[model samples]
Target: MPTDIAFLAIAEAQQLYHWLPAALELARRPGVRVSVLSPSDQLLALVASYDPQGILRPVRLRRPPSRPDSLFRQPSRLATLLLNYATIARFPTLVTTEISSAWLRRVPGFTSHLILIKHGAGDREGGYKKRHADFDLTLVAGEKDRRRMIDRGLCTPEAIAVGGYAKFELKAPRQRYFYNDDPVLLYNPHFDPALSSWVNHGPAILASLESLTGWNVIIAPHTKLARAAAPIVSHAPHIRVDMGSRHSIDMSYTMSADVYLGDVSSQVYEFLLHPRPCIFLNLDHRDGAGDAFAHWRLGQVIDSADALPQALARATGLQPGFVAAQEAAMQESINLSLVPASQRQADLILNFAQTSHPAKS
Candidate 1:
């Protein structure tokens, strides 16, 4: 009999990309049926785009009719899981990118083995929740997360696997966003109010970028943050502000930009895939001494928006000084291997599904 495995996409659309590659890889194999389940039509469409041959099944999960529509307008992560409980419970094994889904294990009749594929490689405390211990298996990008989770008692070494960064397996066609050849700088800020530089210094940073003469700027904040705020507009010809578009999530900005400017976004590690110039914002006065801020060691960390111009000007010249550290950090954050990460992740998931028992409520 074929094993029934479903990839649950209850989080943001950005996370779906991280799981799709593995789902497609698993679907291609015999004796395992992979299905991509989502509440959003946009997400299902994205899966269709990737699976042109219709290999992986697409299942659209619906909100319960008894639930009030207003309450579900912007459903909480837990609510989304609860509302779709009946449909989700049918699968013998379910894979999700967010830890919030672990709550499902407590629901009556929800006996599916819950597997977590961590969505991001950032070192924020929010990423390592106590709920992680509830999952039957967890997959991480590299040694950094594996060590952190074990040390924090979030997951046992046997329950977690360092399957590398599956998101890197996704390939997006490169497109030029700026007309001029002037070096492009991507300013990507995290959404967390306490840790994000944009919460306090966003306008000033944009204002400072306007005065820059030789560089092009792309103001693309984290997708969650952009969705919450009103649409952002850029009047200057040299500056473009993208408030959550497909380009923002598809690695277009990261692959195209020559320099990176950000707060605590994991996208910086993606930008580091090429080892370019990077500048970190420490406007929140975060202590730069811990493992959480380990990425800060890769570039110059500026405390104020006033230092923007000078930092950009010095980034290229200072890049050589940081290249070795950046390379080492990238290796530690994402374990690149001869075998594709998607294949490794698929193998892990398949093995877990065949061997692991259903999670207890």
Candidate 2:
């Protein structure tokens, strides 16, 4: 029996590193109870270990949709409405990311208010707006993103607040880079072809760097790369493919890197937090394209693999300024002052619970 409000979180194993702590903290609030629906077993195991006290209730989601790319995709409108009805039966308030918010709104008690928590670039697309339109309040990682959201068309324009980088604000620093060591480069490629991929001659760019032993490279491809079951990357003596390392949940590698190499990924924002040199592959150079948010202004965007050599040369040459620019952009994009954005998010959940006035069990 729920005495106050039931908060729901839709999570996965690879995402537990960020969501679990936030879930646990949210559960600690006096009038709030936190429950989770995880799509993977690994996430279940992690929640058990992380919150042995059983503060978090766990639920199983329906079988994942058939399409490989659809795992995180929003469900059909009908499906979303049904899920919302089911949640409404058990909880007074619902708190979730953009994907799950629409469905949860079908729950009767959540009619007057909803809260949307934007996780990454994925949320910035259609996924967030679909559900967030119902939100009485919304949380964003920073001011830049809040403007971006407003431009995208979310409801109640005044409802949005800079939540800071919620994911980073929740975790302990994995490790920090020490100076004078051989710099480590984290090459994180997005899974979208429209953005960056081997189709854009990624191998050629890698081949160009074979002679340079100045840095160790960790190739943390998007998780989808691992789903292929085939070799996502051919071995390189200098390049290590971290197929097993879960960036969806853990970002220590991104946190520690002295340099970042990628196209456009939200991880770039995290990398920018520490201020580092970064290189981008401008496969299509969509900087001025109608979709401006798709363009990441963080680093040098090279159009061809042949140009990588010069980009690397420039990155190493102007390391200080490069790091500063990344850091400055990060500050511009997010509100670092909102330490523990997740906690602030939890407080919003509590406020929703109070407003809803759930009936006694």
Candidate 3:
């Protein structure tokens, strides 16, 4: 059956890394039309590189009068933006990596179905919130999310389904950067001002790396951090600061690093894909208890800069002692599959087409 499905990317960077692979997969399916719509030109350009034949139709809308510059700038008002976009788009089914766009189902004039293709496999509390579970259909990566959402009473099994990690299947093998066989650390920090260590312990850690010559560091903070007006600076000869580069979205940093030093971002799951040493910064002063802090069990948690060096040594040591913990965390955090995830996602979308439930007038 011929079907029309649209993949919407509100942000170009992180989402393109997740959605482009699925778009390419769905494009190859017989009698399926896949369209990619994004407000970010950089994201669109990146999508274009993978779509030279124009299989993914591009959709752009004129700014509604007095509309906020971007949905992210004023996220609380996305309903207005989506309402405006509804005038431009009428796809019976719209797929997105953002939960914020679930409002697409609530647009008054249109009765479109929304399927959320979750962006990453992170254990962040917000990612598992009830709001994140709001969608006509939600494609989860593993059993962890499906169970978590059901346990929270957020969404029923009927609405949520497992589709594996689509990005990993599309991921090419990484070419790691090695400097004289030095043990490299990937310092990945979340961009949340209050929850992230970047604004607090990050500069100290970077300065510490500059003074120390023993270890090579990749200061690859969340891409959003680099979007600041200035480039994040790290003058250390052994350190490289990567802020949302095309390479940042790839698995290079995670695979190349021997130890993962991060706070609150789900990329640690990516680093832990092979069960390596990890150190998490607990700037929020959580006691490291309960389901929310399950990831803290995966690595040594440091609260202050005074403990960073010792933590790093233990973190990079041959027997970091956290190996068992790292393994346990990965099992709880990700659902790895032998099946190509993109193919699984395409299958779901195709099945969804046959049984889609668009809102009725």
Question: Model 1, range 76-148, lDDT digits (tens) per residue?
Answer: 6677788788888889999999888888878777788999998888877878888999998999998989999
| Alpha-carbon lDDT of model 3 | 0.72
Ranking under TM-score, best-scoring first?
1, 3, 2
Candidate 2: misplaced stretches above 4 Å? 1-11, 14-18, 61-88, 104-113, 121-128, 170-181, 209-211, 225-230, 287-295, 356-361
Candidate 3: list runs displaced more than 4 Å: 63-88, 176-179, 228-231, 316-321
On a 0 to 100 scale, what is the lDDT of residue 168 in model 2?
Answer: 72
Q: Ten-residue segment with the worst summed lDDT in candidate 1? A: 65-74
Error of 1 at 116 (Å): 0.2
- Record all residue pairs in model 1 with backbone atoms less than 3 Å apart, i.e. clashing: none
Off by over 4 Å in 1: 64-74
* Model 2 lDDT tens row, 163-190: 6666775444556343436667777776
lDDT of each: 0.85, 0.59, 0.72
Cα shift from native, residue 253, model 2 (Å) = 1.5
Best of the two (1, 2) by TM-score? 1
> Top model by TM-score, which number?
1
Candidates 1 and 3, the one with greater lDDT: 1
TM-scores of the candidates are: 0.95, 0.79, 0.87
Alpha-carbon RMSD of each model = 2.5, 4.8, 3.3
